[model samples]
Target: MILIDADACPVKTEITEVAIRRNIQAIFVAGSYLRVADHPLIRFFAAGDAFDAADDAIAEVARPGTVTITADILLAQRVIEKGGAALDPRGREFTPASIGDVVATRDLMHELRPGLEGQTGGQGGGPKPYAKADRANFKNALDRVLTRIARG
Candidate 1:
């Protein structure tokens, strides 16, 4: 199963296509209703309008051999701790050896965000714009993970 923290995810269509082609079940968990395409292999779960609701729901459902897609470092950590694989939208895979450093860096960034905002006159910078290359990378990463799981 592929568990997705779907809010703000840019690879939904790509995921659906790949999962369907591979005959894998994909569950997209979101904070509210999202208009997903109709597909037998794809399921959507709305976790309501609460902070981390979708992440929490995904954590509950993900298990060993499950693949989780999320950009939240904390959520990826949780998924990794649960014996599942986690991949960021930008194709970064979160693993036990790397998650700690990632979390610490994320925490440091969060702590410095206010200072950064002040420096930038309250106009904070956002992530780089998503590009076709990112989509291709994500697809490749997903395929590799799925293939490894299938082999095992």
Candidate 2:
């Protein structure tokens, strides 16, 4: 199963395509309804309008054999601790070995946000624009991880 944190997800189409090709169950979870492809292997789950609702829903279902796609570092940490694989939309996989450092860095940046905001007029630079290469990398990473899960 592939669980997607889909509110701001940029690779929904790519994920659906891969899910279809691989005959895998891919569930897109969001805070509200989002049109999804009409396929048996693909599903849409509306987690309602609560803070972190979608993330909580995804975490509840995460375990071994499940690959969760998310960019939220905290969510990734939760998934990993539950024995599920977590991959960022940019194709970076979060493992137990690396999540601690990743969480620390994220926390540091968060703690620095107030000071940085004062310096930059309260505007922080978000992620870079998603590119063709990112899409390709995500596809490859998803495939590789799925294959490994299937083999085991």
Compared with the true structure, all predictions reach lDDT values of 0.90, 0.93
Q: Write the per-residue lDDT of candidate 2 for residues 57-92, one digit (tens) a residue.
A: 999999999999999999999999899999999999
> In model 1, which runs have C-alpha deviations exceeding 4 angstroms?
115-123
Top model number, TM-score: 2
List RMSD in Å for every model shown: 2.4, 2.2
Candidate with the greatest lDDT versus the true structure: 2
TM-scores of all candidate predictions against the true structure: 0.92, 0.94
Tell how far residue 14 is off in model 1, in angstroms: 0.7
TM-score of 2: 0.94
